[model samples]
Target: MTKKVRSVRPDTSFKETALALIQNRLSGVPVVDRQGRLVGIVSESDLLPREALDDDLLASAQAFFEGTFDWDSLFKNRKAVALTAGELMTTPVQTATPHTLLRQVAKRLSESGLRVLPVVDHGKVVGMVTRHDVLKVYCASDADTLCNVKDALEHRGYVPPRHCIDASVHEGIVTLGGTTIDPEGLRRALALVRAMDGVVAIRNLVRVDSSAG
Candidate 1:
C-alpha cells in the first residue's frame, strides 16, 4: 500500500510554508492551485540566502561594521525577509504515477537529486512521493524474490530433485514443494528462500526423498 499525501496551496506565504515545513521536519512542500492542480514545489534549496551584498556595498558595509556601525541599526537596514514562494519555487516539476514501480521511482529520485516527486494521475496531481516513502514502501514491497532464490539455488549446485522440487512466488510468499534428496536438502532449499530479499514468508512442503527402487 502507498502513503497518504499532504499538500499546500500556491497562495500560501513562504514564511508560513517554511514554518510548516520546519514544524513537520519536511525538506519541502508541493504547491498546488485551488483545483488541487500542481503548480510548483518549494524546497530549502529555493530558500537559499542571497549574496550578502554587491562588491561596492560589501566593501562599505565591512568598513562600517569594523569601525563604528551599530549591529542593530545595520541589521535593521538589511532586507532578507522579503523572499516569497513565488520567487523561489521550482517550476515545471517532475512527477511520478502511483502505479510506477518503487524500484524505478527510487532510481529516478536518486538520479534527479529530488527528495520528493508529485504523484499525478491523467495529468492531474493526486499525491506526492518522498524519499522516505520510497525507501519505506519499495524496500518492503514484494518483488521477484522467489525467482531470485530459485536462480541462486540453481547457480549454487543445488539441483532440484528432477521434476520433484518446484518454486513459485505469490504476494511476497515463496512456495516450495516436491521431493528432495533428504530432510537436509529440504532445509537447504528453505534457507535459500530465507536468504532472498522481499520474501515475507516461506511455505515449504518438500518431503524428504524415501523412494525405493
Candidate 2:
C-alpha cells in the first residue's frame, strides 16, 4: 500500500481536482473530510459530462431522436463551468483495510473495474493501493522469492541441518524437498512459503519421518 496518497477535500473545486489528477498522472482522487475520512471519489469519467446537464434526460430516446446532440459542445461547456468535487464525485466509495488480504484486495479491484482503492483504517483514510501494486506480487523475480523464503525459514530456525528443509524457486513457484522428523515443523515451513510474496504456488516433496526425533 502507498502510505503517501494525494487526495482532495469535499469542497475542492472540480477544476482543481482535474488539474491535480492531470499533474499527478492519476485517473482519480479520493475525497476526504477535514478529519481525513473517505467520503467519495472523483474520476475523469465523472467529470466528463457537464455536472449541471441532466444526462438521464438528455440521453433519453426522445432527445436522441430529436438530433439535438453536440458532443464536442457539451464537453467544452462542462469544462467551462466550475463545480465542486462534492457535486461531481461518486459516493459510497469502495475501500480496503490494512488487514485485508492482498488476494481479497485484488478481487475487489477486479470486480469494481477500478484502478485504485483507498486503504482505510478505523474509518480514516490511511493509504492507497493500485492495480500496479497488486501486479508486483506476481512479477517478483524467482531469485528474490527464493532468498525471501530462505530468510523466513532461517528466522524461524527451520533451515537445513536444523529442520532438514531444502527450498528452490522457479517461475515464482517454490518447491520444498528433503526429510523432516517433525510433521508440524514441515507444516509451518509450508505455510511460510505459501505466505511469501511472489510465490505463485508450492510443491511439497518433503519426506516426513515419523520415527526419527
Candidate 3:
C-alpha cells in the first residue's frame, strides 16, 4: 500500500482535477472530505467523454476522461456531474483494510475490475493499493518470504520461542514446524503467516509441547 496518497477535494472543478491528474501522471485519485475521509475516487475513466460529458472535454478530458477511470466497481455511485469533481467522482467505492492480505486485494481487483483499491481505516484513506503493488508479491523470491516469516515470528510475543520454531519456503509455499507450549501462540503465528503478501499457502506441522504443561 502507498501511504503517501494523492487526493482531491469534493469541490474541485473538472479542469482542475484534470490538470492535476495530467501533470502528476496519475491514472486516478481519491476524493477526500474536510477531514481527509474518502468520499469517492476519480480515475481517468471519470474524465472520459461518455454520453454524460460535453464535446470540449474530449481532447484534454480524453487524455484523462477517455484515458483512465476509477470509482465504485458497480458504478452504483455514478451520477451526472458536468464540471465539478464532486458530482463526477465515483462513490461507495470498494476498499481494503490495512490488515487485508495481498491475495485478498488481488481477488477483489480481479472480481471488481478496478485498477486501484483504496486502503481505508475508520472511514479515512490510509493508503492506495494498485494492481502493480499487488503483483509485486509474485516477484518476491522464496528467500524473502522466509526472512519475512522469521521476522514476523520474532516480533510476536504470543508465539513460541524463536529458536524452537522453524520455517521453510518453497516457491512461496511456507511450511512451519516446531513445538510450542502455547497453543494460542501457535494459532496467532499461523494467522500471521497466512496473511503474508508473498505466501501462496501455509502448511503447519508444529506440535504442542505437552510436556511444558
Query: Candidates' lDDT values, in order?
Result: 0.66, 0.81, 0.78
Off by over 4 Å in 2: 1-4, 48-58, 61-83, 96-104, 120-127
Q: Give the clashing pairs for model 2.
A: none
lDDT of 2 by residue, 1-213 (tens): 777667888788877888866764666788889988899887777777655456544564455598866666655455435488887677888899998888888889899888888889998878878888888998878888998999999899887768888899999989998898988988988987887668899999999987886
Q: For residue 127, what is the lDDT in candidate 1? A: 65
- TM values, all candidates: 0.51, 0.73, 0.61
lDDT of 2 at 76: 48
- Name every residue pair that clashes in candidate 1: none
| lDDT minimum window of 10 residues, candidate 1 | 73-82
Candidate 1 residue lDDT tens string, 1-213: 224545667667767767755654556667777877888777766654434436536765787978965667545434334255655567878778977876667777898788878778876666667788765632543445655767777775455544367777777787777776666666776786675556768888776767731
The number of residue pairs in model 3 that clash at the backbone is 9
Name the 10 consecutive residues with the lowest summed lDDT in model 3.
Answer: 71-80
After superposition, candidate 1 runs with Cα above 4 Å error: 1-5, 50-82, 137-213
**Ten residues in sequence with the least summed lDDT for candidate 2:** 73-82
Write the residue-wise lDDT of candidate 3 on 18-128 in tens digits. Answer: 886675455677889999899888878877744544543343455556656433422532443447778778778888999887788999889877788889999998878
Q: Could you say which candidate leads in lDDT? A: 2
